[model samples]
Target: MQRIGSLPSDDSSPGWFHTSRLRQPRPPLIGDAQAPWVVIGGGFTGLAAARQLALNFPNDTVILVEAQQVGFGTSGRNAGFLIDVPHDIGAPDYIGDQANAKNILALNQRGQHILRDLVEQHNIVDAQLRHSGKYQAAIEDKGIAVLNAYRGGLEKLGEKVQLIEGDELKEHIGTSFYRKALFTPGTMLVQPSALVKGLADSLPENVKLYEDTPITAVDYGQKTTLHHPTGRIIADKLILANNAFGQYFGFLQGRMLPIFTYGSLTRPLTAAEQASIGGKDFWGVIPADPFGSTLRRTHDNRILVRNSFSFNPDGRHKPGYTDKVRQSHRLSFERRFPTLTNVEFEHTWGGGLAMTRNGQGFFGQLRENVYGALGCNGLGTVRGTATGTLLANMLAGKNESLTEFLLAAPKPNWNPPEPALSIGVNFTLRTGQARAGLEA
Candidate 1:
């Protein structure tokens, strides 16, 4: 069938990952090729699937295609918190049912463990993997209430968490704007784009990676055919890892909402600037309200800020949208760090997040020979990785302990089409931000 969405372009959303060290380029598809399995999209999910497929079926060949370079898409644009707890972005509080909360923790920890091995064995310096816990901070009373509810829920699940209030919270974040915070030890921090690139670079020899190659069309049958600009690929099995773009391909169209979230990274802080806004050298915080801003202090001393969400039905943004987001980022930065008056954001970008109405995703066989995994519901880092790894195992018929739990997890609920979707999503976002107030 003909493709519906465009390839990921770097023109509009240039991020800090692009400014990082140079990487060896991989050529796009140039000729016809046949493989036992073909995976589309080169982000965390696709790379993980390709790696597992190659390792499990060593005798068979696998081809992985990327519309843009690895990490140029959603995988690379995230704020880099690998959360290992319940995080439903649409809800007031992140916690949920006791049994399900435990499952969420186990599933995320499983994904992080796998990623830790890859980072260590491959010596992926770009990942900058750190096992540091994450902080959830709240400025308003409503946000503080959310944190309290979350803490209570975590206690019910028997998860370890530390509550910080007043002076303690200020000392930890170097910001008196927050009145309370919660520290969850299982979460991790990493440089997202680098992690995806490292995984792609360390893939097994049996996997052939093609970058800058966008799939123009795909005809599915007993043998699926993928058509690109320069060539075509025929594989016996197919795995779809393109998250938000899945809607355009007649998969998860009515079941997922493709939301665009914006983030900006500041130029590395000067020595004086760092001292002026001092707390810990590096730290990350998630807002108590899901709609509030997410902040991070990079090891290199740069401050990264993420806030603002819009429903981009087409999965593409007008240039003006990004400029507006940068302005919002600047306002948020100035509000929280008045002491660092001269700080400026060097890069601002937006990425697609596939969210489902029920906070679940598509994670099993959608067709006879086609398996799919996407719709991370805004927790893409750990959720995407865990689901991607499970996709590979499911294809290979490996029923590990977590496989059954994931397979049986709730699926995405159907959503309305354009006019209604546009209206509802925008209204909800605006209402949330309004309620979040300064937290936003």
Candidate 2:
């Protein structure tokens, strides 16, 4: 029933938007279920963990529960940038210590490799795998200095990054506003919904997935029970991959905040219009806007413009998602590329990224043996993928080096206690939007 809005179970995993690939039929549900481990959330991280568990430890039972269909949240709604290193949109949020930092880098690079491998191994038809790198473009005067400073972080990671200036910037992204830029080649782009469906299809047969089943309650301890309106899943162990929605679990809610982001694709440009913008090769661009606008080109020549606005663009929320936010990405895109304003908004959607106060992601065991991973902070393709792998390893048995480092605090510290939760998120969002409105 949810169409052209934020992803949610049964709500809007949607039949709309630029072609989201078809997915496998939802698995039959079981009442009072039981499994060795239950992953609550059918998005990327949950599925990734389930797939790995079935492959590596086939004997162990894994059950994935989603409120709606697979790839129902950020995983399905992402702009499909399977990126690698050097882009610090949200990496700093997950790496709290030296060990955490190294793990973050290693796993992200691993995610890049993993994404390609999945397409090949599974023969995912919808996977239009292309190795299109990402370009960072500067708009205002201060943007150049900000990018130069960012280059330092890229260098510290020892990952390869190419900076674009003058002619090259014009060559890649013709906008004159771009004074400086950065490029990383390993970033692959795909149709997010299709990629998600492909991943779901590849999930192990033994690992059951239930759609249209919203988890209403969590009963913790050795045999944690995940309760739904019509059924329940009782598992020996549990892994929380619910992201911003994990707050209902009580232990995870305030640790990280939920940041909302949106994206829109223009109706395919005609030959002349496409040429006017620049070459088709300049597909990906993200200007460091105060609210963060991301741009990309679709396979069929549509231009995808995106941005996220939280209750407070820079503040907090119960780590989760909402579909009701008023869309401003298309409006902002019109301002950035006025000539293209007439191009209709082919799609308008938003997703929430789990975020921490210090910009570090939270990982590790939530309770005794129950492991958890969330807080991609808008860089999920790489960060979420990597964290999923680490969580799997940690849950498997003895802690891997990466798992040991991240276990320091599996969730972010609680949210501020001043106003009510809902009130707080909206207050910040209203304030941020007010400021942006004034500046505009």
lDDT to native, each model: 0.83, 0.66
TM-score against truth, every candidate: 0.97, 0.84
Off-target runs (Cα >4 Å) in candidate 1 are: 10-12, 89-93
Number of clashes in model 1? 0
Cα displacement (Å) at residue 91, model 2: 12
lDDT at position 123, candidate 1 = 98
Candidate 2: where is the Cα deviation over 4 Å? Answer: 1-18, 28-30, 86-101, 312-327, 408-411, 420-440
* Per-residue accuracy of model 2 over 1-440 as CA lDDT, tens digit each: 11111223322422222365555558657577789878877777887877877776788778887776665566777777876753444444222244555566676777777778888899975767788888766665555555666666666656567888876676676454456777867678877777777887778877887776777766677577777776777888788787766555655556667666666666778887777778545468766434556777777777776665654332222233433332466566666567776788755666667766655666776676577777776777766776787778766674666566567634466677646765877776667555444112
Top of the candidates by lDDT: 1
* Candidate 1 per-residue C-alpha lDDT over 1-440 given as tens digits, one digit per residue, 9 for 90 to 100: 86756555543455657755567858898989999899988877888889988988999999999988887788889999888887654444466566676778888887888888899999998788887899999988888888888888777778899999887777777887788889998888998988888888889999999998888888878988888898789989888888878766668878888788999998899998877766888789999887899999887888999999988776665567888888888888999999876887888998888888888888888786788888878887777778788889878888876778888888889898778888999999989877778987
Whose TM-score is greatest here?
Answer: 1
